[model samples]
Target: MTKAPVTPLLDRVHTPDDLRKLPKSELRQLADELRTEMIDAVGSTGGHLGSGLGVVELTVAIHYIFNTPDDRLIWDVGHQAYPHKILTGRRDRIRTLRQGGGLSGFTKRAESEYDPFGAAHSSTSISAGLGFAVANKLAGTPGKAIAVIGDGAMSAGMAYEAMNNAEQAGNRLIVILNDNDMSIAPPVGGLSSYLARLVSSGRFLGLRDLAKKFAKRLPAPLQVAARKTDEYARGMAMGGTLFEELGFYYVGPIDGHDLDQLIPVLENVRDAAEGPCLIHVITQKGKGYGPAEEAADKYHGVQKFDVITGEQKKSAGGPPSYTNVFAKSLLSEAEQDNTICAITAAMPTGTGLDKFAAAFPERHFDVGIAEQHAVTFAAGLAAQGMRPFCAIYSTFLQRAFDQVVHDVAIQNLPVRFAIDRAGLVGADGATHAGSFDVTYLATLPNMVVMAAADEAELVHMVHTAAKYDSGPIAFRYPRGNGTGVELPETPQQLEIGKGRMVRGDEKQGRKVAILSLGTRLAESLKAADQLEAKGLSTSVADMRFAKPLDSALIRKLMATHEVIITVEEGSIGGLGAHVLTLASDEGLIDAGLKIRTLRLPDLFQDQDTPDKQYDEAGLNAPQIVDTVLSALRHNSAGVEEARA
Candidate 1:
């Protein structure tokens, strides 16, 4: 358990080509150094730790084996790609992971040549890898394409779809199914169970061969024969299987961490000139590290930690986070109302619903990582007169947009969406950013969208969503701690589509006005104060509801202020777009009132601290103040000089 000093090998690796030159024996030493550096790096900046540790050897082996810049290797979900980042020429920038203008937490094509394919979301790697493989074949390039996907990710329909199509295309492709036995938590669903059995049985080389025992004695064809034999055996052994029917030549149940086992099997799969192949390699979640191996989920994503003790660095703070508050409030409501129920798409602890699950086991549902099913399931429960609260991360909810539109919104189901991680999520980068939900959900006909200003507001939103049986209701709150706001004794429902004025002078000569949404209210208030100090009076309104635009408040602000600025945490089609649409309808533009909307830029914002990200997006206090002043000066110049 001795801590090794960060060595020169760690320092020198700024690219994969550099890594390819080193001897295979030196890789073990490099992996040890990489693990130490990763532990140390993530210890300082809170980020995903255990996944990176689990993939160290596999990452090393793949980069060493494949001609990376030419041969594309796609990583699924990107959470586990931290070590991949380190070895693939981003080692020097590793310290800057998740910081503004720093290294991204996931695979990004723009970041390096090694990351030929970028991924932030789960269940996307296989499809992306197939694209690369097909492209390589068309170009007649001397390159290989591989997808290192986990067993948990394979449960998703998209991966299977890719496998079906890839096998039919008959391209030389390799798929390494990294069976880590955990996906954030112990993986769920039937696919996970089948994979577990696959691991236990160890590749089905002799399920029942009518052809002969010598098929097992054959070299490359052994995998093909085993899959054919296993398919027939599975008809009677369990149920008629789905994978081989899809056409993928399934191999493995190999030990992933065993370099000897992994290298040769991968070599065999690589050498074989045939259709799509899957190498199912079983690996413990936290292979090399002891603490991570013991507590896989806890170490899944960790804060700066003491490497020796495996204790996360504590931030001196107070009170429950918004997520915790929402969970507690929901549980309290569920206790009183039998009709109240909760559903999460694979996230239990992350959404803080573990408490609710403990209290009301019957009402709690974890629908694996299937967001689409989670939404429709909530809708179904609502149809039966139950108030179902579907708690999911804002980014994840994007995957179920069609369900929200068709099933819940169209039917006007009483489904409450308690959306966590609503705003700028730090470190995880653009792939995990919850920036588009406000826009996407707000436009739906019967849907109600609300954002929490603080923990207290989140409590109210939770109560509001629970009690109101009108239609589908959504309440969004940002990631991390609340602003130390005291929670109400009991939740109170706010009037729908009504906005609360945060700061403004009723008599001030309409110099400026700001309508803000979500957690960005604090920054807007600060900017208003700064604008007031400079003899530039300003008003700030918290447009709590993104949907059902607060028309009364918008009209009032338009009448008073000469300049209007809308601010929100989401992207192009969000709160700002709604504001502009309202303005155009009211003919505010023709009235010569200057208005500008501020939001996240068109391009993806890289990994950074949340505050830094907002600042970069021009949503911070200084940026807001500067934007207002500049707009005012431009207006005054055009009018005053011409009148003079």
Candidate 2:
């Protein structure tokens, strides 16, 4: 058991109001204490460490400068809000972060009044902030809307779209660009600090205002020339000419870590009565922690770690993750087919495309935080006679639904969607759960959807997608390590729209049939064992494809079995829904044979262990047995009631 580090200043802060009471000079010490507390808390809980570390000072400065709850301060992608959580009346529960019934990893509206808008997805904060700002203006409320977004988030088109429309809110909207790359600002030292102080102060802006008025009075041509010259000069000094063109008053390229620089600038921005402003603040991802700074990812997300050594606790060695299986399998396919390529939206490593990138540098594309562009880009590649795999997380892929429908499905393109994280992603909560991908993609006219039952099946699916050149095809796999099944030496392309019976023959007096999609096959097999032990003959089948479901297999199961049940790890409109629709359409259930569908419940499940979540959804082995027994009992009772 690890003990928390001493945090004297942080201990004093129960909320942002407590933070606001402290003098401006004491803010740097508070920020240090806050960073320590954040590091210690995340070290125990194992969550997004680097992002929170990056924004420690900024989080402190904002709360100190602005009256939050009243003034809407939204954190984009919310992974960076751990420190913000610690300061905003959640410090006691900070250690329980990402655990069951504990605090969420992202900002949630239900969690706190301070978090006006919940966010786990990137590039949404600007638009949400604009909504708040416009609503406040209409209501005549004395509040401002501030959106703190990252540089990576700005790559998405939605961020720019929000920026283009930002003038509507005028002074009510504020956009703070947290540039971790330090691309927008000067190096962190004397010159950057000096420049930041001068610009944030009233005197510098007063002179600039005077110059602007004088320039407006000049001849039209001279004024235009002067404006261009001024824009160019500012662009050379501070990199925000593009933001200015999008109708925003561009400020800074300031040192985000320096409290003296940060506090004054935030104070200035808070007091300013002008149009929308974009303050470009440079920050380091892992500013304070030595181990985090030294790491390649800057420990963007971490597991439990030793505070002294910063050595993360290693997981018990097991089978390779589904992500690794896909990457290796895709690489194998690419070796044989040179035209095979991979693309991910700012998640090369997350999607295992980093392995592909390393192997095939020219063929791998990392379209930074742009899922919509990634989908269409793959379509373009497929259009030009190349096998393109758009590897994106199922949750993030929702951002490209329009492109998936319009550019890929409607056009009948051969772009392969390698959807990872395709089930309840534990700890990320409802926002990041890959629940709807099956329903969304299976409903498409020209789309083919498949789910892997295990790592070996994932390899086969990868090969299938590579060889497939018909229309849009997708294959989904979950987040964690695969079940310890032996991998095939070579990849094999599975027959599309087919399923295989894993247990029991049709003539074996099969009274109960369990049809499983995705990784729930193991549970189904276990349920079959339990049913067989109870003198109930049962059959289990693994249905690989959800879109082009094995109707023949369904018909065979329905004919042979007295009771049939469909199981999947996805939400309601997924495999179970498809199976039910098939049974109805084929008139298979007209004989009144008992049938049941087990799926994730209608509500968004909160963050918990994957096993616990599945258990809660009643998709486990015991639940499956209970469903079958319950269905049989109901049928018997109904028949008895009719006879009476």
CA RMSD, predictions in order: 5.4, 2.4
The best candidate in terms of TM-score: 2
Candidate 2 residue 638 C-alpha distance from true site, Å: 15
Candidate 1 residue-wise lDDT, 1-644, digit = tens: 34545567766777788887887778778878887878877877768877778888888778877777777888987878888887776766777877777877788878888788787778888888888788777877767788998836876667877887886435457787887874333323445435434523323323333334656567867768665675666433433255457776565455556565555556656665546767666677766778888999899888878877888888777867888888888988888899999999878999998999999999999887789989999999999999999999999999999999999999999999999998788777788888889989988998899999899998888888888999999999988889988889978889999888888753455678898988888889999888777766789989999988888788878878888988899888888888889888877665567788888888877777888888888999988887887776643234344224
User: Which residue pairs collide, candidate 2?
Assistant: none
lDDT of 2 by residue, 459-493 (tens): 99999999999999999999999999999998788
For model 1, what is the alpha-carbon lDDT of residue 467?
A: 84
Worst 10 residues of 2 by lDDT: 635-644
Query: Residue 193 of model 1: what lDDT?
Result: 36
Q: Which regions of candidate 2 fall more than 4 Å away from where they truly are?
A: 183-189, 214-219, 296-298, 507-509, 634-644
Q: After superposition, how far is residue 291 of candidate 2 from its true place, in Å?
A: 0.6
